[model samples]
Target: MNNAGRDTRQSTRFMLLYALAAAGGATAYVPFLTVLLPVRVADLAGAQDIAWLAYVAFFGAIASSLSNIGFGWLSDITGNRRGWIACGMVLSCALLLCVTQVQDLTGLIAVIVVWQLCLNMMLAPLTAWAGDCVPDRQKGLLGGLLSFSPALGALAGVVVTHPGMASDDVRLMLVAAMVVGCVSPVLIMGAPRRFPELNQPSAIDQTPRKARDWAALTPAIRMWIARLLMQISEAALFAYLYFWFRSISPGFGDNDVARVFGLVLLVSVPFSLLCGRWVDRHNRPNLPLVVGAALSAVGLLTMAAAQDLVLAIAGYVLFGIASAIFLALHSAQTLRVLPRPEHRGRDLGIFNLTNTVPSLIMPGLTLAMVPLFGFSGLFVLLTALAVVAGLLLVALPRPK
Candidate 1:
């Protein structure tokens, strides 16, 4: 390639990076719009019963788990991600707006269910788009860029919900949604659709099942499963971190939660980006995945051991850093092993179940664990899970 052509290519890749980051940024608002709102939903729904939230969470998990494959399959056949992205955003935002008007459990449940479905529809295709263009070598960088978006979105959520700005919070969320809606078109217009070769099972394949088939578990698929397990450990903490903080240290408030989560994200962003750079430079993505998961396990254990809020915050920040590193590299590695590149949207959707399935199960598991294992026991269990996941990653054959 000519120097100018090479420079343009480099520029295009960087733009793609920022676009991915912005898409990640958009993902941040979901917690506020969905999971975080249930507190309000309890009051609005007149049930004041968290069980309803759990029910919604359970169903949402199912929808999220299924939508990945459903939309991914569609994206694979269509070869156009932008349309799905736009439709998902618009439908989800409308649902968010609709949910704000709900005033009962039935209404809340119905709206949330639909909203979750649409959000997943958007996310499945959007996430698959990441693997579509980027090669395995740059997956870590892409993962880092994708990882930071939630932090940015979290900040946006905080800004929109300033104390006494209740009237405007919904509006701000809508604005966030609108900003995300714009991302797909801009990405479509700018990024070149260079269709890379797909990794397909042979036409005359004698194997009983395709590796991507739900039943088949290749080394790479096993690695992805490990990544999913790690995410579940993280989700277990996420589902209950606020409740635990409140139970253990009620003096801390929402701002405290946001601040702690924000600090964690802040620490994580640099570490994640650096980990990605290290992976690209040295080709050692798995090492970081292993180390980061271990660190996170330690952090979780520390959180359980903490006697004061400061210690807990420290633990949270450490966990955040470790989780971020693992997520960035683990995702890149998973992208490398997908059974079908043409079906990235489909395969990634299925893989994302690892991420979403936990969200569904973790909350109930946390509640159940606390009664039996208590918080410390929960942490210990989480630590063990993380270790197992890390070891599984180590066991996977190094990708060529």
Candidate 2:
């Protein structure tokens, strides 16, 4: 094979490793946040104080948002990605293990805040590192690979929380170990430094241009908005998913929910991979993204209309698959739309707001909506949000 082919192969391998590492990092905390933390909080604060789960989520979201932006900017300024990831992973692992020791609400909150910061330190830079290295054409494949992260996260939750697990501390330790093990490949191999076309000037160079230059950014901005709206729906559901399941079927347990979630994610993986490949081959990401959003809306509406456990699970599956496709495709497309290569890290950080901000708002949104209208109302709102997200994508100008 030619040099270009070899580089492409190598880059593909690197991105695969990076994607897995990202998944590992996510596994460490996502389950903890979505599944374990709520249970732990309820256990410590009393089942009646379940509202504290929202507070903890809010705190963690704020910390993660700020830290993600800060660390992304710092990586750009220092011109280093690997070091930040390594350092952050180490600190995150140590802190995660410490979480099992927290005995009170205040202590738990403190640990979550710090843990969020540490996790973002790794995540932000890791995302930036992708823009720094991956060629635009391959972003779709990368995004497809990224879909595995959430699946792995859900599976990790199942593993750690399984009834046969040793102890909470030991479970925590296992999560920490997974984080280290997953990230070790990227760190050990070192960040890829030679993508010949990796940061070449596109139409939207840092230099000033006319209205058209600004217009060029609209696609990325639209995708950002789309992801934000869809994520709001996702965050609302994820935060309350456990409770929702319990309310729907009091007989079901955490393991049952995890199994359903994991199955949905696993089903999404191959579909996401195929969607990514289609996006890459066709150079038409918008169609898939918009379709995914629409699918999510359908899923939300399904959930809103469901009156039984089987129906609820079906709705979740639809929503989960749609979310997986949209997120993976949108992520792959992000690298293509960034306006400034010189500040790719910072720009990507800004884009990440779409991810973190939803978490911040979802808690408040859920509390306000659920009390007034119940889960049905919440799902209806989410359905509308998903539809709007798709519409925004439709508004974007077609790629040149």
On residues 113-196, what C-alpha lDDT tens digit does candidate 2 reach at each position?
998899888888888888877776677788889899988988888888788875778878888888888998988875574775
- lDDT of each residue in 1-400, candidate 1, tens digit only: 6875553232455445555535443553434543356456546655434566666667767876787689888978887777886777777766666655766777767776777778776777777766666666577776676666656655555555456655634754654464564455555565644434433542435555654355334766677777777888777655556566776798866556665666666567777878787887887768888898889889888987987877877887888778867875676678877755766787788788888888787768777887787787788888888888888877666555
Residue 5, candidate 2: how far off, in angstroms? 3.9
lDDT of 1: 0.68
State every prediction's TM-score relative to the real structure.
0.88, 0.95
For model 1, the superposed segments whose C-alpha errors exceed 4 Å read 1-29, 33-35, 42-50, 168-175, 178-185, 193-195, 198-217
**Which one is best on TM-score?**
2
On the 0 to 100 scale, the lDDT of residue 309 in model 1 is 77
Instruction: Count clashing pairs, candidate 1.
Output: 3
Clashes of each: 3, 0
